[model samples]
Target chain A: MLCVVNTSAEELRRIALQHFARIGFAGASLNAIAEEAGLSKSSVLYHYSSKEALLAAAVEPAVDRLAEVIEGFTRTGRGAMDDEFVQRFVDLLLSHRLEVHVFINQGQSLADIPAIQRANALIQRLGDAVTDHIPTVRDRIRFGVALGGAAYVLVAAAQWSSEPLDDLDETRAALVDTITTLLADLPVSSAATA
Target chain B: MLCVVNTSAEELRRIALQHFARIGFAGASLNAIAEEAGLSKSSVLYHYSSKEALLAAAVEPAVDRLAEVIEGFTRTGRGAMDDEFVQRFVDLLLSHRLEVHVFINQGQSLADIPAIQRANALIQRLGDAVTDHIPTVRDRIRFGVALGGAAYVLVAAAQWSSEPLDDLDETRAALVDTITTLLADLPVSSAATA
Candidate 1:
């Protein structure tokens, strides 16, 4: 019985995540999520107390993982541009593509939500970790482009494409490679120096 | 008299854009906009027939500029990776930073709005223009990362920073340089090949 109840809650979370990701949190309907999960509205509420609660449940894991990634950066102080760090970051992003989508795109508008606030705070910490070692404004922006760019592209690919990214492995490897390249200490451009 | 009317309309657009960029279209209220502009709601309506119309007016110039940029790409078939093209693209993003923020972040939620639909379509055309020459998914994602990444960073910088980006010239130069480097045909990684 406990196992069945857990499964139902898990199923509701999956359905809710898809809805939250496709539509903004403000736009997604709790009733619709309940209906999609083949449960009554009250039952949905039983599992997650409020719409915000459901949102918190759906996005919390991703937020926690991101926090962990940031913690790793804090510990090492050298992992921001490391290959393993980039790979881990890319994998985390791909794994939580939908949650990351919500965090990136809707974060500002949904700032009042506690889950989103925590997620946003973690993102600020992550930015600091990545940019702390970088000296110049140009270089900091480069890392910003690389990290924020990777997040946006993955979210966009998921949103824009009619089909699932069939070449997931290829896309993942490419993302890691591209981000690492952008973060690498390449020669300063003449235009930038000028 | 004509100049005064035009200025009032222009002022409304400017105020409306800041609100829309900050809170989002659905969240921004016409009454508040009118209050900010020291005009009545009816007077605000006189300038724009509806909220959607106001949104249309606010975003149309940026859309037209992007359309022209894509047209340039289509015309030359060789401008996507060009330095001049990248510069123009970066400038468009910075000059209309708020509008780009709305278009990038709130676009999915506001897709029912005609203005947003038009903007989203133009983005698709722009994506096609940039990626048409690239064969591999990796290369295509690279272009996505560079272009989409740049857009995301600029929008984020504007939103996150308490003060305006003081070194606009340096930031712009770095963006152009980084994007050009990403779009340039560099050697592929072994991981990408595998």
Candidate 2:
């Protein structure tokens, strides 16, 4: 019985995440999500008390993972410029493509929701972690472009591609390479040759 | 007399763009836009028959500018990898930061709106122009990251920053440099050193 309830809840979250990513959270309907999951609206509510609750459930794991990543950065005194951190960040993004899509694009409009607010705060902290060690606004914006850009590219790729990305390994390698290039601190003369 | 009408219309668009960028089109209210612009709701309607029309007016110039950029690419055979094209693209994004923000983050949710649909189509054309010459999926995703990432970073910077970005010249130079690096097709060995 516990297994049955857990499976249903998981199924509902999958459907809900898709809806939230496709349409903004405000535009998604609880009824449509329940119907898609082959359950009554009341049954959907039985598992998650409200639409906000459902959104929280659907996105929290990704949010928590990001939080953990930030915690790791803080603990180790490592930042986004670190190659291992970049790799881990890219992996996290690819794994949670839909949740990141919802958070990046739709999270702003839904900031009144406590879940989204928390996610936004986490993103700010992540930004701080990335930029705190860097001095110039130029370098700061580079980190922003590299990290934010990686998230944007992954989400856009997932959203716009008709078929799933054919090669995840290739995508990951290309992303890491591009981000490393973006974040590298090279002298202007060397950059020209580079 | 013509200038007076034009000034009011421009003012309304300015206010509408901010609202759309900040809260998104679905969450933004026409009434609030009118009030902010110090005009009556009827006057706002007189200029733009519907909320969609207002959105169209607000974003069309930026969309048109991007379309021109893509057309230049097609006409000149200068894809996103070209240095001049990168500079021009970065300039357009910085000048119209808020419009890009609305188009990127909220455009997906408001696809039913004709204006957003047009903007989204332009972005697809821009993508095609960037990647048509590049053979690999990896290169394609690289272009997506560089271009989309630049736009996302700029918008996020604008949205999240408490004060306006202090130096446009530095921002533009850094963006052009970062994008050039992202799009550069360096050999694997040189890339390691670069």
Q: Pairs clashing in candidate 1? A: none
User: What is the DockQ for all candidates, taken in turn?
Assistant: 0.51, 0.51
| Docking level for model 1 | medium
Instruction: Quote the positional error of residue B180 for candidate 1 in Å.
Output: 1.1
To one decimal place, how large is model 1's interface RMSD in Å? 1.9
Q: The CA-based lDDT of model 1 is what? A: 0.80
- Where model 2 places Cα greater than 4 Å from the true spot, the runs are A2-5, A78-80, A186-194, B1-4, B38-42, B78-80, B186-194
Measured on C-alpha atoms, candidate 2 has an lDDT of 0.77
lDDT of 1 by residue, B1-194 (tens): 74745988999999999988766676688999999999999999998999989998999899888888777866776533467677888999889888987787777777888878888888887667655656688888888888889998887877666664788999998898788778767332212212
Error of 1 at A60 (Å): 0.3
Q: Model 1 chain A, poorest ten-residue lDDT window? A: A185-194
Task: TM-score for candidate 2, please give it.
Answer: 0.87
Measured over all alpha carbons after superposition, the RMSD of each candidate to the real structure, in angstroms, is 5.0, 4.2
User: Which regions of candidate 1 deviate over 4 angstroms?
Assistant: A2-8, A35-43, A186-194, B2-5, B38-42, B186-194
| Cα TM-score per model | 0.88, 0.87
